[model samples]
Target: MISSVLPTYNRAPLAFVKGAGSWLETADGTRYLDLGAGIAVNALGHAAPVLVEALTEQAHKVWHVSNLYQIPEQQKLADALVEKTFADTVFFTNSGTEACELAVKMARKYWYEKGAPERVEIITFRGAFHGRSSAAIAAAGSEKMVKGFGPVLPGFVHVDWLDLEAVKAAVSEKTCAIMLEPVQGEGGIRPAPDAFLTALKQISDETGTLLIFDEVQCGMGRTGRLFAHEWSGVTPDIMMVAKGIGGGFPLGAVLATEAAAAGMTAGTHGSTYGGNPLGCAVGAKVMEIVAEPEFLAAVNAKGGFLRQRLEGLVAAHPEIFEEVRGVGLMLGLKCRLAPGELVAAGYAERLLTVAAADNVLRILPALTITEEEMAEAVSRLDAAATALETHLA
Candidate 1:
């Protein structure tokens, strides 16, 4: 039999019928612990009552309207984002790729409007995963992402990650912006050190280059902070956010300071369903929950517990895992075996995990996962490691 849908993803041979709070049920009634959490989209966990209520209520009233009109839901979400982060303005998009597109455009337009039309080049780092759009692929500059695509986009300048000297050399007057991920997600959960971030900020300030942070995967509550850059106390001129902001709904946003967004006037950029009412409603509720001080504190505590347990696992099975790295709930285990092999083993153990580059396994549990769920997740991982060892032996 042929499949109807486009085979874009190498999907697992499993179909989940329902999910609730750290667990997913397959069509055949088999339950699995859901540590992936829809690739970190379900920050409040699956089928959270607060998110469900918000979505249901908004769906009953209004689902979408044109951007020409004043959508109260959109305004409320924008207001919440502005209040929480360093941004003074917000532009909603349907996904992180769109937000990345806007961020690039906004940076170029800022320089253009300031009478420096030649300053259109955006300096991006290697191993950074911005998104999948044309601009994003170019910004990422990865051969795996840009190989089959036609001629790559022209305005992006790629450099090695953490190479401060290279970044300094790259930032000529033609450079419009310096874009990077505070914590590189698809690049194998590598975090830019706090000192390195501060250095980048200082260099950007000295050179008047706009700094953009693609926080799509590490933002929200994934890092036990509102945004990962907050941990370094180094803010970007513009930031991209998504994945968890809608609590499993599809929504993304580009946030900018006032001066950074000065070039975005009427008719500059717009989306038909960017800030749709339903998405904004759910996003507002997500903000309310994640922005709570107690909730953030709990995430930090849970992250500590999970990291400690994972360290123990690595020590117990040195042949399986090399080390554990990453911050907060967004953790990664560097494996001695191929990450895909461990992923298959995890499926057999009825535990879901995500794979990343450099033979790393990503453990992105929901922010609201309970202590018991964390323990179970570790135990399942232990079993998977044991199984792999036995098979290899």
Candidate 2:
């Protein structure tokens, strides 16, 4: 029988009625420590007081005013983004998927208007997960995402992230841009080497190919930086941001340099619900909190603490965990078995974790999570691993 709602998701049997900080509570008051953070969407944790206040205050004032009119809140967020990063302008969207859609169009359109319409192909990489949109799946070029969706959107060339030679070989005068994530979130938390990113920047500068980074998961204080690209000291011509940017309010944005965004004129792109006062209000609050120097430093310190703990955990459970990967709070446990087994075992321990490709179990807690919470999460993980090991034995 068909469910009332679409069954696209392999949803768990449990449901939470409320959440506070890094914990979720069922209707009967059984609490679970939330390390997944809604797949890295809840930046400030569940029902953060500041974000809740921002949303409610804006909700009381006004909710929706179409993009046809001026939106002061939107302007404030865009200005904040421009000031905090390499961007000169910003366009708001309702989700990361929408941001991906616009990034592709903006990059291609820049060349089309610059009298190079043939320069439309964008060089991408393997193990990349942009979004579920047609353009995003096309950019990934992975068979898992594009198998049934025949006639995938064209103009994307996939290559190996580590093979600088292959990346160079794939680039041509017809190449319009190079798009990739600084860290692969779904393909397992793999951070691109600094040299690889630097080489890509050189390629972009020399060939007039624009550089695009999908920082939806690794940005917004996740990688102990305002953006992960900062760690590599390389800046992309265009960047896509979402997930933690909204603090779970469903907001996304495309930040780009003026030249890159030149073709995205008034009518080039837009959305009815995008950049609404409510979403912008929440997004502005998130930026204000996350962009603070002290907050980010604390995030880095906490990340170090948690990572050290995870390293010890991995050493203690070598039979189950191969190693640890990722940066800041976006850490992953490379499981020896299917990652799903760890996720299920975590549920048994009343802890939440996310599973990803390449046999990894992702641990994406809120940036504000304290050291004590991290220790507790690690303890729970140890217990889960121990139980799984015992069951296997």
What is the TM-score of each predicted model, taking all chains together? 0.99, 0.99
lDDT of 1 at 201: 97
Error of model 1, residue 307, in angstroms: 0.1
**Residue 250 of model 1, lDDT score:** 96
Candidate 1 pairs with clashing backbones: none
Clashes of each: 0, 0
> For every candidate structure, what is the RMSD over all alpha carbons to the true structure, in angstroms?
0.9, 0.7
Clashes of 2: 0
Any runs in candidate 1 off by more than 4 Å, and if so which? none
258-318: candidate 1 lDDT, tens digit per residue: 9999999999999999999999999999999899989999999999999999999999999
lDDT of 2 by residue, 183-278 (tens): 999989999989899999998999999999999999999989999999999999999999999999889999999999999997889899999999
Candidate 1 overall lDDT versus native = 0.94
Cα error, residue 242 of model 1, in Å, equals 0.8
